[model samples]
Target: MNYFQIWGIGFILTLSLSLSAQQVPDTGYVAHWNHPPYAMGEGPVVGVDGAHNNFHKLNAGFRAFGNVAEAGGFRVVSVDESFTEESLSDLDILVIANPLHASNLGNWQLPCPSAFTAFEIKAVDRWVKNGGRLILIADHMPFGGAAYDLGMNFGIEWENGFASIESGGFGDLFTDHFAPFTNADSINSIRTFTGSAMSSNRADVYPIIILSEGTLNLPTIAWNFDSLNTAKPLAGYYQGCWTRAEKGIVVCLGEAAGLTSQLVGPEEYPVGISTPRVGGNLGFIQDMLISLAPENDDFMEALGWLRYREKTTKVGDIPFRFQVIDWQRQPDGHIMLSGEIIGSAVSFEENEEDYFVVEVGPMESDDPNYDDRFSRWRQVSEFTFSREPIVYPD
Candidate 1:
């Protein structure tokens, strides 16, 4: 699909500090998916943090983030309360984007305190250790400083500064940097606006977006680069990384705009995923979310019920059964449900929503006229099974 057709063709070559203030969510932007992993509202629940004075919320800056997750078949909802055991109990994944301390609200400078309290940090740490995934994003100086404590608890050392390449404040991150996560053949590049950099000494932590030769300028005030600022080379730092936290996982991004689709300035110039340069960002987001989501056991349980029915039922006084001998996932993210009934094999591609019969013949035979032979069983049945008992119609 052509992203330009949806995002339009107004790209901003450079994003200045002045233009950053004018940025807003692109309300028209919609995340398109060729194959959603689950049925609508059937996937894992994702909570977008709205408390702690976050700069990105569901109805505002991170609107595109929620849309992307929803398009990928996850249920997205806003989290309006602080981090706690009870508050995070129901969430499969927690996304905290550019959260800020109340003291730093509208005033980005030195003395940027932690957005999360000691109790909140401990709660989050325990929650992740108990199997709650987290996506922590902090951008630039103040944001990095704000999320420092929460990030540090997970082994990430946030540099509270602006990361800039030789080109400018924004640059394209290539596939080489996404090692152990994605490959060059899968994705070409991802564009990121001016953001911060981070590092982790933990061996378990895998680098996602590593910075090339660049400078990290630590200014006392946000975006105020002067001689007074302490500048350091950002050669080995990371813009994004991920690691496992006991039973759960943590994905830390030093930048926020890369996950967002927003318009900048009066001209409405595109930035982040909306820009033409970052066409692969949507795919990246989908892959990341799939990794964060728990295994799809609901589909497997539903299939188990069918297997049980096959083993117990009979047709016309003759023992009738269809057993799923083998199954595998296709390249398009659909499952190939392969089964045998009365020594004849049938195979079909299925998503969580429904099953589609594609072929039917002998186990190792290839028949061109198989479609004609199994015309009546083109579709097996829609899987409406849940934890409750199945009721049959008389």
Candidate 2:
């Protein structure tokens, strides 16, 4: 991911910012959320509409970034207001709720305009490459607004197909729950959570949420929102899992159809169920929004990187790194991140050399009691020289 001037800032920010008096950083948003009740779903989780999402959740999240963080806080502004070179310079993070295909996320190496435009790819490249945190919410099978445009940065996409749920109420298309790849039966000593009816090619990842049961199957076909290919939606989530690929962390969907759902609005909400709380759509919206709040370390960073739209190879420790890796930006905007690590360095001659080879696919989200380290490097790179991240193609 490249980060030149996301949201139009005028400086480069890093983890080095002071811990006591952080200022607010310029942040941008992409408009994609558009479901009736507007993409709402919740069973056991607790969420409150208009509470934190705008008034409730956001204020708290920002308080930590702005008032709490030493260097700066996250301030959401209009896209036009924030889109600029200088703003990008000072931008600490960018959140793309559900981006669609655009001139951004492009490829210029092709003889003609690539399937994607260079601008389309480069915007994301510059943002992440420059250490900007990105958060992306992707749609699975049914295309939940604009999710894939940002999802691709991490090598993930909604399967764009159908979905099914067994032993649960609602249609077979409505699923009860979903699982991760690592939680399934072991094959050849490695757990392969693919082709289990719900998901395919699942990898171990920090899953945000999975279908519990009674979830709808996505649209009946797969189509690029940008291209409007309408190729036919694929199968959807059904207690499924998938493997993340590429160099960045990924969150994948079962099928385009699985992500399809109805959103709950103020008029649509029902109150007085949980005493002071509302019931039905309103309650459901609140709970789901809370889940979407990203209640862990640096929610902004995690979400930003997940939706990164560039073409670079980046890997890092979950809570450790809050920004994207540095990479060269392509002329047309698309970035090229390829090259094996330089092996056999003169610095560490012993077994610490294998750290350069640390690579992994998507993470599994189904297991409640799973090891985070298991989804990443098989062996942690214990470099005698910790300061060096040997760069290739230098």
Candidate 3:
């Protein structure tokens, strides 16, 4: 346990130092998209969108999804400020879920409803192109209509309707096995409930979850009528899609409920990811988050133990001995790192034998030939590794 604690010590040194000096900056903060005129603040926090229609972080309606993100090492923040380069500069990701303009929320009908203005959309475009991630959740009818314009900028066309199955039972909307976008066998099970459909035609854009063959989108003035009601048909589209641009990534989900956990009434019937009937939503969302924010590393719990031995190394004529330990594999299949400094020369060989090597210490100069200035010992402060386990030696 002590060793594990020490393992994270390097990662938090700067944070600890800042806290000790009380120099916390409000910038570089996580912000959940919220503007009262366009969004609601039913919760105590002004930026929190607690309205039944919105999915702000502080909203009771979105607690399940919020908790899952927090559990995964992300702090859910509320953003009230308008979208601008300076305002959005601090954020790594911006989430807009089931948003509605102030006037539209009164009746919740959509002839024309803009969740975000043209300027705001341009600002978001600039932000994403500068390496910021965006998550847009537009569920059914009005919500989809509201976010449709912004989706178009990313090459997404949202079908403003309710996604359902052609065979048409209540259970038709409940997908037990959603299709995976890639060839990977990581298919997920989920209940979409009532949501919109989307499609994108950009090279960088890819589908993450596909609604089944029988699925269709049903148009409505409002999401009022039952599945049996006469509605316009919108067939063959994606339930979720993501885009990977040169600088950043964008993920869009048609159904917000699939990622959420909530009760319908006082009876407290489970909905979304919380229901036993629908599972693996957490893994699906986590994968999306990882794709959007590749810089955020997953912490692996250490297993087993090893002993270290001293070995001699040549820094020109000077002989230096350092402790080198046998590599131990972590549960995630990467080699566990020891609290020792090993230079670039031995690093590759170690990785070749271990498949993946975790190295912790200060960075060295890029020059192959070491200089006296670069030879000085710098303490291990942080350890960063590839998102996927390394296969080939490099």
lDDT of 2 at 384: 24
Encode model 1's per-residue lDDT on 193-309: one tens digit a residue.
677889999876777766766677888888667633678877788888888776777889877777888888899887778887665677778767765676732223234334445
Backbone clashes for every candidate come to 0, 109, 0
Highest lDDT scorer: 1
Per-residue alpha-carbon lDDT of model 2 for 1-394, expressed as tens digits? 0001111111111111110122221122111222221222321122111111121122321221121111111233323222334534544434332233322223211111112234544654564554444443332322232333334544444433222232211222212222221111111111111111133333543343233333233332332223332322223332222232222222333221111121123332211111111112122222223223322112222222322311132233111111222223234332222212222232333534322222212344677765343332121222123234434343
Q: Give the whole-model CA lDDT for all candidates, comma-separated.
A: 0.67, 0.26, 0.49
Tens-digit lDDT string for candidate 3 (280-352) = 4555555454334434221111111111111233534443323223234344334444333333444423344
| Colliding pairs, model 1 | none
Runs off by more than 4 Å, candidate 2: 1-73, 81-88, 100-118, 139-146, 161-204, 212-394
Query: Measured by TM-score, how close is model 1 to the native structure?
Result: 0.70
Query: What would the TM-score be for candidate 3 when compared with the true structure?
Result: 0.58
Model 3, residue 108: distance off in Å is 2.8
